[model samples]
Target: MHCSTPKTSASLDPALLRANFPIFGNHPDLIYFDNASTSQKPFVVLDEVCRYHTEQCANAGRAAYSWSTQLDRAIEDTRARVAKFIGANAEDLAFTSGATESLNMVALAWGLLNLQDGDEIMLCQRDHKSAVLPWYNLKDILATQGKTIHIKTFAIHEVGDYDLKSIKDQVSPRTRLLAMTHIHHVFGLDMEVAEIREIVGDRVLISLDASQSVGHIKVDVAALNVDFLSFSGHKMFATTGTGGLWVNPRVKDSLRPMKLGGKSEATPEAGGLNLKHKNTAELLEAGTQNIAGILSLGKAVDLIDSIGLDAIESHVSDLTVYLYGKLLNLPGIIFAPGMGICRCEAGFGIMSFRFEQISNLDLSFVLDEENIFVRSGDHCTYARDTSEEYIRVSMHLYNTKDEIDQLIAVLEGVVG
Candidate 1:
């Protein structure tokens, strides 16, 4: 679904927003166009993380000390904050290192438990390795488990568009799960999760890898109707080594927890080895936890909300559209025809293209020499049909028109 809210008289002041990030100050000439990889943290997030480690450091949820108790509430409150940010229930959300573990958690916990002989799982060619390998691991285990499982990869249009009718054809009585990314990292294809959900219905479970979609766009879990979703914090202006997994409550009891040890949320006996895990996310979390990183993640939710998601989406889209217009006149630049210009909805602030005169790596190297950063190569999309390495220019709220102009100027010189 698209977010097309009416623009207020006072639009986002990107310069003021850019000033909030410390990295820009540290390197005066740095043009960070690699947000799809990881976002630079705002001072608010950095301060929150710093405060957690220096002033209130403690292991949460286990100790009787006052610090631990307070930290426990703080951690849980962060969970509530993220849930509210995504329009999800706090009880349905759980903490993980990042989306990778989140995807793996669902694959091992749910897929391994539920999938058996005659059951089929569908994945797309563009899915990240994190999303693909977990299912592949499950496929490998099937032989030892004495089960027959079928895995299928459906085709997308050459322009990175999903064919819902083609997808419907792939589903059958044996089809159990449809695991794909809500926004593709390479092509920036925003799969119609709502429409895909309608296609699957109650017959096939939907697992969405929303690592690219979450912070870039406004995503309501209720609207998407996904059984499981995985997204990272570093991609969202939060600290790295922190992210989340959201499980639909309808199947919470069905998916077992992957990591388990020590005390839990509701277990009464102290130091009990084998204890009952509460139905909530406490069953999923273990060990000392990334207290600092999680707190920063909570702050990121607040930061994004304060800016307003609609404004962020609108601003990023405008920048992408403007960049596409400038690049179209340049020589030998190639992506899906009309992709960045016409299908701005499909490409969420990311433009992946190739320059015929220069190799993708050389193009990236030249951009880096100018202090303009972008990711190049396959972007972890090994399953895709495209053979040539590509240049990926990803934008964010802090990206100014001047930066895009600089990028276009450099590109023109290279092509000319």
Candidate 2:
């Protein structure tokens, strides 16, 4: 282990930030490099969850008990925190299981309400299954209704960088909706969002799958001018069952609720009220809700803010660039073009490469034997043609320079 002294935070202290995460102290040897999949929770978030279950364990908007009231407050507080983090109004944010559920809610509900024959939904090939599958499923259903479901994709150049012109050209007057990720999960390339919005020019509604970009970087949905956005709490250091979806005020009334019943009505005028006709967020979310998970989400947001996203991003870029340089020099290692550490405009915490002589499964197994965990395969991007698979190592704030060195050491031994 390397000898180190704690640095005092002039802004948000990294050392103080480290103390807030129990996992960092408890598992000193564990190098968690798979942050793109899900981030480890900090102690503050864990305590929030523990405190909620132990003291405020009750349902919200129900019986008039003290615990229930506390639960309701906690849930609403999380909604506010999430909204502030992304620059959206709290009333526009809706809770769901995760990004997967949030996305499905939008696709199934919004697709049913607005989509018709000859309408188009454009997406990127690099989106995760959570963002891709729901809309694809809805497309199938729409086809049965005699509505044409046209799929248009924005292409990435051979170097893994996006060709913004391709997306600009793909948008037509008939395009009704566009759903895509804010960042490419496979390669960690940030999407051209503002440019895409300009090209669409209010002719179509834009939905962003912000699951990968929200916690890692700064996201302002209002400034970006997106109609819808979905992100998971687990990816941002909260519990897995918690996530939120943003529905812009413009199309709030148009959003439908695919699931309903149990604590969803504002005021039931009839015996069975209309679930799909409520106000913005309420119309989309209908359930008991994950009260504890939502509370933890607020804590996670606080933790990220205290540490500072800009500092974390800078450190991660440095680490990734260093790793890229070392890996590029190794024999039999296949390096994707335009991927070198972190460019100011392009890549971030995630980077993917492969070994020419070794299969992806074999490479991942060998790396795991050394306890250097890394992701392998297509990584759920359905649009990608599988001519070549990859091995992925995604870093986060908790990861250190030494850990990146260790990853290189193990890969060198395995490949050699």
Candidate 3:
């Protein structure tokens, strides 16, 4: 592997990690390249989920009973665990349905609370619909208050390079928030948000969707200096509908809750109104908690930590380089780092492309017939449509060189 980093991190054995996932045992020949959608959970995370339902099943933070106490403790501990995992305080994180819900909460709560007339939010075409939709859906609501939200995009060349000038030009003093993704869903474009932060200064609140890169890489919320960030637990090997949002400590008071009910992650008073609502995670998460999923998500973080982030990053980066090298030589493969429009090498979770001879769906079918799985089409960038439909081959810690080789063999005959 001619990667910029080391070829492999032998400290964490990829084969051993692969064995921990049950799907490999069930289908030995299966090559799961759609990890960006949802990752295959390790037995550790599954066991934690089952254990929660079997042993300590109870509603959290409601009753003084032992079961409720146990469940509540588990939920809070997991919250702290997830918080530390992302380099933030426990209070900064809030459990939600997923990144989508988390982002929506920010848009509906923070945007509604702070935005005024002539304020704007910046986004880009590369953003997944979930990233854009949350803010995009707010135009009408703001209009009622005589507010007009001017949405803008960061100018990106077809080659996927950032136009720094456009970033400086677009982010005016009236910009309220800059909403974008840490990694583009379609083609694995890992954006350097630190630079974007520098350009925007403190003019706008930076809300990042780190759904694609959080568990796979080392993401320090403090270091990124973002006001708000959201990520998916399912994509990080946790349960579906399990994720959290990180709200900057300073902004928690300004950001309101999207879902509210009679649940005591807080204390109630004799007046039937809140005596005190702590500005921690409790402020954002309301209603009955997903204790089982939250516990399992904690276990998922444990599984990733066991391998070590540096090792995991090294392994995937190497495999991506290897896959790029093999696939680039093939004719008609477009938009991968070394092929088509993008000239840089593929370095993250996905390698997306459109083939010349075969449609993406047809290619997906052929791979499916071979027991090789992949994802095709626009991949939920619903607003951003190009002339070509792209297929994404996303990788995880469990993926190996052998599986990549098998994929190359399948594509060689079809495209040649």
Tens digits of per-residue lDDT for model 2, 1-416? 00011122223334455666787788666667778888888888889889978876778868788877767877787788888999888888888888898888888878887887887888866668887778789889988888877878776666665567877888888898888778667766766777788878886898899888888777899787888899989988998898888888998877666777776664556675544345666777677778788888899998888777777666666666677767877778775433643333324677888887788788888877777778888888753454446788887777776788888888788786
TM-score for all predictions? Answer: 0.94, 0.90, 0.93
Q: Least lDDT summed over 10 consecutive residues: which range in candidate 3?
A: 1-10
CA lDDT scores, all candidates in order: 0.82, 0.76, 0.81
For candidate 2, report its TM-score. 0.90
lDDT of 3 by residue, 1-416 (tens): 11135445555678988888998999898899999999998888889889888887778878999998878888889989899999999878989889899889889879987888888888876567788887778888888778888888775556554566787888888897988778766656667788888889976799999998889888899899999999999998998889989999878888766767776344456865452567647778778877778998999998888788888877777777788788879898776332235545447757888788888889999999999999998888753454445878999898999999999999997997
Compute the lDDT of residue 40 as modeled in candidate 3.
93
Deviation from native of the Cα of residue 222 in model 1, angstroms: 0.7
Give the TM-score (vs. native) of candidate 3.
Answer: 0.93
The root-mean-square deviation over C-alpha atoms between each candidate and the true structure, in angstroms, is: 2.8, 4.7, 2.8
Summarize candidate 1's per-residue lDDT along 1-416 as a digit string, tens digits. 33233243235878999889999999989999999889999999999988988998888878899999999899899999999888899988988899999999988889888988989999875667888888889988886899878888775666665667778888888899999888777766677787887887886888899998888788889888889989998899999998899998888887766766665544436664444666557778877788899989999999999998878877877777777788888888787422553355324787888877888889899999999999998887663454435898988899989999999999988996
